[model samples]
Target: MIDIDLHMHSTCSDGLLEPEDLVNAAGRAGLGVIALCDHDSIAGVARAMAAGRARGVEVLTGVELSVAWQNWRDVHLLGYGIDLASPELLRCLATFAERRANRNREIVAAVNRRLDHEGRQPLDPDDVTALAGGVMGRPHIARALMARAYVASMEEAFDRYLVPCDVPKTYWPMEEAIAAIRRAGGAAVLAHPTSISTDFTVLERLVGGLAAIGLDGVEVYNSMASEAEAAFLQGLTRRHRLVTTAGSDFHGIDPGDTMGKGRGGIRFSGALLPPLYARIAERQEPL
Candidate 1:
């Protein structure tokens, strides 16, 4: 049975379920371990951990930071075993939230302007915030677009008005984020490398560069990763001497389905946990 999922989201960010409800669902899904790696937010982690304890699910301290490298779009870094009280993390997250809110407002204004030009009523930005509840995101905007029938699908919505440029550019440099994660007593793992691109040759160079700096692990098992992709990632892990990790990247939007099940029923073994724990411990050890 698939019991371990190290990545997911909750309403604390752009997810559809609240922290408690997400934990409950994970429990019902037979997930033994999970992490609430909400986008650039840790507000849900404490609640998730508490609920995890109640449901006998181990919730790790995880946060997925939005980062950008030179010409690379949306390079997310996942920090595991971070100290929840780290002031550095808290401060950065506050700025991220503000920037994200501003970005969402910009996109809404742009969309509304276009709608007004077409003689349609403008969409209230507040409606999008109501959907997100916390950190605003493109998914929230997409939902709002869908509700208004402005677009038939999420893809068309992005293609029409909510393009990436509409979003604010409040992001950390990849190196800076990795260092911050380390300072917070966490192991930094590159989240979903396969999502970067399909070109294995380019990915190899990217992984090498990241590893040369301080990347400790790669997400080898994820819904987006194919079997061949997973094997390629495993080879990268060995070559880079990095830890291996897996995650379903559950966002709680897909209701009625249990958590921890990655794309195409990909299952993770309990055996994968120790290496990550070991990496965390190693990071915590005094040099």
Candidate 2:
């Protein structure tokens, strides 16, 4: 059984739960260890660590950065064992948050324009931010649209409107993100390559580029992967000689779907995974 669920979010980013609440939930769920891999933000790690310590659960420090490929496809890069206090990492994350905020605004504008054209009620930017818990994103927009009955579901919202191809938006440069992770003494792992719509050749090129820029691992088991997809990723990791990582990608409050919790039904022995726990201990050793 997987006792450690490594990819979770908190109110520090897009998740619905607060840091303490997330840690407590992990403990309640019988998770021995959990990592707070918030999106582009380490703000929740300290609180999560404190909560974990109090509950006799280990908390790993992590962040999921949004990186843009050459073709404008977005990839999530998970950085583990980062020195959250490192000035370079802090600076880079600040810039990323700023860019994400700008992108959120643009997405909101697009949504509003589309709604106006359709003669429907538009979403207020403030309501969208509230839905996002301060760090606005396309997911928040999707939720707002859903709340207003503009879309049937979150997947529909993305497929029909919010995804990058459906709207004009900018993404953070990939090379710079890799450099920032390296500067922070962290390991950058490619997160869920299946989400990128590309051929095998493009995927290989993307992985190669990331590896050249100091990428350390590839997520072989993700919440979204099928058994076959997971096997393919395992093969890809071996081919690239990249460290393997796996996670549930828990987003807390599942939006009409129960897919991202409790290992995401991707069963594996926690004892067999060395890199995941080793990275956790390495980061917690200093604190």
Candidate 3:
């Protein structure tokens, strides 16, 4: 019974826990294998790997890259078994981090303007980043708003103010994300497809385009998906002959209190399944 959590974040991204803390928490939770799929950065992977080694847990070097398509659909591509030390990948990630910081600033300013119109004190980026404990994002802004009793929850914050359509920032395009993952010799898995948009036809088109662009997998069993949705995604994976993957998408310190630990206990079982450890090991093997 190998417990695997393929999608998790650390403070290297927006997650509450540091890399080492995340690994230790996974070990405490009885996870046999874990992937530190931090958003747009592998900066935490090495630290997680070290922690995993100490805890007897296998850590997979992974990342979750944000991809935007022409249809205004935001796609998240999860890369597994990537070379964390790749200079090219690191450089690209640095650019992405800079862009993300800029986007966060824009969102902060927008949220502040909205709050100020309501005669409320606005949150500064510094305060939001302090609350985030690292690079800030909409989630941090939402949390700050919640703390001030402005928004009831993260979902409300997004729905009212920070939705992509209303925000001034855009995600990196899909083709660019796919190419970066491919160049790193990593397998790209679509992360939590249902949460992005509700249109199944649009999702189908996105999956088709991603497959054509060399996408290796889809996260058919995500913590957020209902049982029926999970089954549907599994069917879609089969239909497309795509590698089906599962993940908890654990972001420590839940803001919405919607997504739970271990991705609602949806763990991958069986030796035949493509486990994160196996992928990392295969990548480590000499060619």
Best by lDDT: 1
* Candidate 1 lDDT (Cα, 0 to 1): 0.85
Q: lDDT of all the models against the reference?
A: 0.85, 0.74, 0.76
Pairwise lDDT winner, candidates 1 and 2 = 1
Task: Tell me the lDDT of candidate 2.
Answer: 0.74
lDDT of 2 by residue, 1-287 (tens): 55777788887787767899999987887777777888888988999999999998888778998778677556888987777798988987787788778878878887778778888887898888877764666667887888888888878888767874244444567888877775676777888787774356666777777777777788767767767667776777778767787677777556532222423464434563577546445444644
Candidate rank order under lDDT: 1, 3, 2
**RMSD (CA, angstroms), candidate 3:** 3.4
Best by TM-score: 1
- Evaluated at residue 249, the lDDT of candidate 2 is 79
Q: What is the TM-score of candidate 3?
A: 0.81
Report residue 279 deviation for candidate 2 (angstroms): 6.4
Once superposed on the true structure, which residue ranges of model 1 sit more than 4 Å away at CA?
Answer: 146-161, 254-258
Give the range where candidate 3 is weakest over 10 consecutive residues by summed lDDT: 255-264
Candidate 1: count of backbone clashes, pairs at least 3 residues apart or interchain: 0
Error of 3 at 189 (Å): 0.8
Superposed Cα deviation of residue 35, candidate 3 (Å): 1.2
